[model samples]
Target: MLSLWDSWPLPLETAPPSSCSPPRSSCSARQRSCSCAHSVRPIVPPPATPRASPQYVHNSLGAHAVITNIDVTLRDGGYRNSFNFSPEYALAHARSSVASGFDWVEIGYRKGSSRPELTDGLTAHCDDEYIAAMAREVGPEHIGIMVHPGNLGEHDLDEAWSAGARLLRICFSPSDPRRSLECAQRAVEIGYVVCINVTRISTVAPKRLRRIINAVSGLGVTALYLADSNGSLLPDEVHALVESLISGHELAVGMHAHNHLGLALVNTIRAVDAGATWVDSAVLGMGKGAGNLVAEQWLAYLSQRRAGSDRFDLGSVLELSTRLGESVVEAAPRLDVTDMLLGYFDLSIEHSPRLAEIPDRHAQVRAAGLLAGADS
Candidate 1:
């Protein structure tokens, strides 16, 4: 069996693309047409029994396309506060979210032995105690925890499940894989909403993206999230990715956009318009670097898409972003030249681990950014 932790440069199709794989170039296309599954490889072959003609089922409740917003203020937003949020603040946000009709509230990261050594905040650690504490305040069903693929073990997941994390958002970087699908498989078995977050989607090539997607799409996870890690993707690219992902399955397609280019909202809307059903939003766009799509803004925009959108009360959303979470965004990041250059270069936010040892490293990066007119 091929291990998910195995080295990179996944196998690509030698033959031309056919009806089985519409996008002939994608690594998944070969899996679709199993006629030559093993003509070239020394590894396991594609699913012996075909995928029942690509039905594309889902958990949403509509024949018409709809948008479901997942609030990431606590998770991604944590990057701004070094993964520290007052338990009081987290519960208040959760309560506000329920009132505002948010589909899901991401509470924090679920770090394990694999996390980098740092002064991580309470939520970054997300001990059973923390998760349980958060669960006590908010309905466990309404909360989700974002975790990296390499960091967690079965025990970590078991503890999280016991602590009330019914939704698992596994963030995976194709550059350094950590058995993401295996994690999702575990999450699904535990009766959780499994969301596979393909982080840094723009940085990967189509073949690599397809390979990863193809590998995980069959896992029966609830959704596949494409994260614009560097906030570098344009609206068209967002649309393209959403379209391609939904083309092969009945599962929900989602988008998580960063605001490096000040296009988080635009890119998010484009993805939704292209059939993406799930979207992650931060109140006032309070997240890492330039932050993320504004929940209030995106929800308000989505509310106008159809009548009976009252299920999402913009007034409640407004109050939370302005009142309950206002201070949260008081520190919201601006779209600076450095952020723009990061997007332009399409760099992942993960700086070199070696830089962590250097003191005032953020200052150095900022200095470089300013020199590059990052402040302009």
Candidate 2:
């Protein structure tokens, strides 16, 4: 089969501007040009308005052949509580996830090459000993870990595998994913299932992102994940991106959504509708900023529509959420002004902590807008 990139050039190119500014509604038109130095057209046309109801793919048996559900509670939830979930709590969470039929559990990040002086808690580091213990508790086959290119130490990938991680997700900004691609290549060569996560999907121009995805599709990865790092994307946008990315490729696609806009669930469903195979969630929507798609809620929604959904025992997930709420999380996830601003402008979660420090609400909003311009 031909790779998706085979049909297109590796570099991104923009069409000549016919007008400095096109009408707002028709802005999605490919040849309707803009004079902005940063303007780059989407490789795929914008999808039509999405329906209120979700569309799912069915199996040959005519039943919803469920998508893979990867639980990120321990990994992402770490952002909310400083990675303080104890080994015992982590074990319990993993066990419950297994029983609930989650395909994989991202226990945490691999200890990074940088920030050696910083003292983050267990899940942040996911030391060999810690991962080994978690693997022992909940079978290594279900364990995965995330790593940023900056954080992937020379020995991290091998060590993670030795400690029993079966899958590895390498996350990097879409602006420059070369280093992430390199790390993912190394992990794949080392006998691990690898996924390359292009973070902040909304910030990058579609043509640029398509090139990045095209580059990634050749690296023998298990999947290419679209990370809504800032939670700025709408369901229709998700549908367009996922649909375009998977158009002629045999590679599996996944979605890692942040719920800053209260749209993660809808966005995720849209991605699946457009051909994504894997989707991420946490028990109580626990994570950084406004948190992620709620695992319990997603399973509940799936059970209502997908066949053989009984394997995903919604009660187990709900029980896990309740248990984690009492013992692990400091507070439930909620959207705040800062989180909303982050999503609105397609800024990153790193900006959230600083945005929260501003004493005045108006100042915060103003600062967010300025930051957006600076980033753009």
Candidate 3:
């Protein structure tokens, strides 16, 4: 046989590109279809892969959605002082929220005829003029106002929008969601970014809560916020709830955690891990009963976890939080025995007035358990 080297059509050093190489588009159709090594293109190296931020995966529930932080200091903190937050304090809180990179600041509630005995404070009522001033002071884009489904009327959306309210949060009980849905529909029509808050989520049965969530998600609301009004939810529960709510819905899920068991931060963290995109916190944990998740602490945690990220200015938030302590003598968040009982029994803070009359702490807790059973 002839020498094996003599069988080659071209010398090894001058051989064409390998047959395994892909043909370039510039190659003629005949060349591309042929097995000839001359038709193959030279190999090109791929560009280097970018190094991803280590914290990016942990920042959310394995999703790329940006989480929105909401400051509810003026809105929820008012409960501690009987909704008596002064105009100056409210405006200052809104300013601080904006500076701290908060996405929204809920100034206060819009009063209705249903609860005439609540208080006469501007924050409680969130009168048109007060909202107008806050809108102007903080920029309407960052201003949010809450209203009970019962409190929201047909024309309330128009009034709120005209007064520069960009977001309207409707808080409603899961027992009856019709009114809340109606209000949300109206708000959508009026061009308000509406959030439907499911209050006392722990009290509702699982099936009922799922139905409520499904219904709200189908509506055109901007967000569906679950309110741990009793502060009875644990981290695991929050994770499951948030995960379930986010499974098939494109709607943004939010958490409004109460600090009854001192689990707000952990529960909120779990919610975020389960795809909740919005988080509510109050300065100094000032709110009703055991209070809400503390804003300063929450921001500090985020700042530490998301190192090198400048989304939130923890220093600015802390400064604003300290001012609350200075301005209000009774602004501290307290978790008394009564508050613990409220959380243990899954009783709402709204019933605290009734529980207070029991006189005995043991009896109070027992009464709460009974009340929760009855309410359920």
Any runs in candidate 1 off by more than 4 Å, and if so which?
1-63, 112-115, 175-178, 324-326, 350-376
List the candidates' TM-scores in order. Answer: 0.76, 0.81, 0.80
* Winner by TM-score between candidate 3 and candidate 1: 3
Q: If both were scored by TM-score, which would come out higher, candidate 1 or candidate 2?
A: 2
Residue range 1-376, candidate 1, lDDT tens digits: 2364476645532222223322422432112111111121122222232111111222223346655678998877777777677777877888788667776788888883135475387667677766766666656767688888677655787778777677889886554554767777777877889888877676455667666776676677878888887787777667766766677765788899999888998998777767888889988787877889988888787667654466676888888877644565444546755565567545545542322334574664553344323212
C-alpha root-mean-square deviation, each candidate: 12.3, 11.1, 24.0
Which residue pairs in candidate 2 have backbone atoms (N, alpha carbon, C) closer than 3 angstroms, thus clashing? none
Candidate 3 lDDT, tens digit per residue, 1-376?
1131133222112113223333323512111111111221222212322222223325345566666778887778877787787888888888887777787898888873136476557677877777777777767777788887676555666777777678988886433456667778778878889888877776555555555566666567878888998888777777876776786765888999999889999999888888887889998998879899998888888777754357777788888878889998668768877787677666777788788788887677667767755655
Question: Candidate order by TM-score, highest to lowest?
Answer: 2, 3, 1
Candidate 3 residues lying further than 4 Å off, grouped into runs, are 1-61, 112-116, 173-176, 357-361
Q: Candidates sorted by lDDT, descending order?
A: 2, 3, 1
Q: Assess each prediction's global lDDT (C-alpha) against the native.
A: 0.67, 0.73, 0.72
The residue pairs in collision within model 1 are 56-249, 56-250, 57-250, 337-374, 338-374
lDDT for 329 in candidate 3 is 67
